[model samples]
Target: MDIQPTSGSAGQTGGFAAGGAPSSGGGLINSDFETFLMMLTAQMKHQDPLNPVDSTQFATQLATFSSVEQQVRTNELLTALGAQMGALSVSQLSGWVGMIARAEMPVHFDGQPVTISTRAADLADRAELVVRDESGTEIQRLPIDPGRQELDWAGVSDSGAPLPAGIYELSVDSYAVDELIASDGVFVHARIVEARNENGRPILVMESGQEVAAGDIVGLRQAQ
Candidate 1:
């Protein structure tokens, strides 16, 4: 199957870059060690037999090289381990495909009723569900029961005419008598259509054509 690259947040990419794993430290250390050995051989060949080279200095230099080599190998091992972890993350995220995820995002209307899950403030007495179009114009307003966590939105205008199928936004406002207590965006359950890697992190594409980070998902369940 062909895989397509997905765009991700620039902030996330920057954070990933800040890690700065030393992927090439091993090769650089090996090159430097070869040069060190050549220089030591040349110095030995030119030294006088009477004076010769100091054995202590030679021992110290060899010890330093060994320490540097060990550090480089450790870095290489860490880099390999990071790669393996990344692969494992992708494999685990792949299991989310075909599952249902609940997230706070825009909804896509396809000429059918969409199920929206929302939460109201604990002290609120009533809640209102407001639906808006892509242009941010209010299209429908309905009083919702705060006790019921789920509501269905039929694609229709206030005049009982069907609205055009497209992306829309849903928000819930809680009221205490005449005062507005809390207002928050609503969440909806959508099937995971695909999973893609963005900046070494998993991103889920929903059936609503929305792309959200896996971390942003608040709930997950089996697809119906």
Candidate 2:
């Protein structure tokens, strides 16, 4: 891929100036560095015969310039590395399209339901799953256990009637007491139906029609 150098960048070195069109007369070093070099060189050349320039001070200035240059080079390398890594990550995540992934999200009590594989402390009292429709409206509430439980919503409403197939969310609530906090809630294991980018960030489109960022992926598996 051809990467056109961004505008107002080439001439600006270390936040120096805004770059316009390219010029051949000017050297690589900006006016500031050039002026510093000229002043230092002139001072050394015009030093008095008796009180000459200090060799140690000159060495220190040279060392400072060298260090600054190295730092600039290091920063450029890091920026390049970051851009390359971002591209690679986006490309690799695209392979997850059409696959099922377990992503961690705040989609609590959405339409999706939760499933527990094993029993845990206070499974009966704590197990609760809530489902929601696309508009974030609560649909139904169901009780669950810490053990293997599938809180599947059969695309039905609270009146036990079939609803249109669309995106939904699930949230898990495993509270101990009436006024207590809990963590065991239903999670989503949605199939990634599509892969796309949102605001330059990679995202996965779940079969439930929910879009999730690639960074939100907690687990991944092949489509089955």
Best by TM-score: 1
Worst 10 residues of 2 by lDDT: 13-22
lDDT of each: 0.76, 0.56
Q: In angstroms, how far off is 133's CA in candidate 1? A: 3.2
TM-score for all predictions?
0.68, 0.63
List of clashing residue pairs for candidate 2: 109-171, 110-132, 110-169, 110-170, 111-168, 111-169, 112-169, 112-170, 172-185, 172-186
Q: Which stretches of candidate 1 lie over 4 Å from their true place?
A: 1-26, 37-76, 135-138
Candidate 1 lDDT for residue 179:
86
Candidate 2 per-residue C-alpha lDDT over 109-154 given as tens digits, one digit per residue, 9 for 90 to 100: 2433433232334534565566677698987776656455544445
| Residue 165 lDDT, candidate 2, scale 0-100 | 57
Candidate 2 residues lying further than 4 Å off, grouped into runs, are 1-35, 48-50, 105-124, 132-139, 161-169, 177-179, 193-202, 207-209
Candidate 1 lDDT, tens digit per residue, 1-224?
22222233322221112123223464576676766665556555554555555555555666666676787788789878877877777788899999999999998999999998888788889988888999999988888886548878887887999889999999988889858988889898899988877767778999878999888999999976
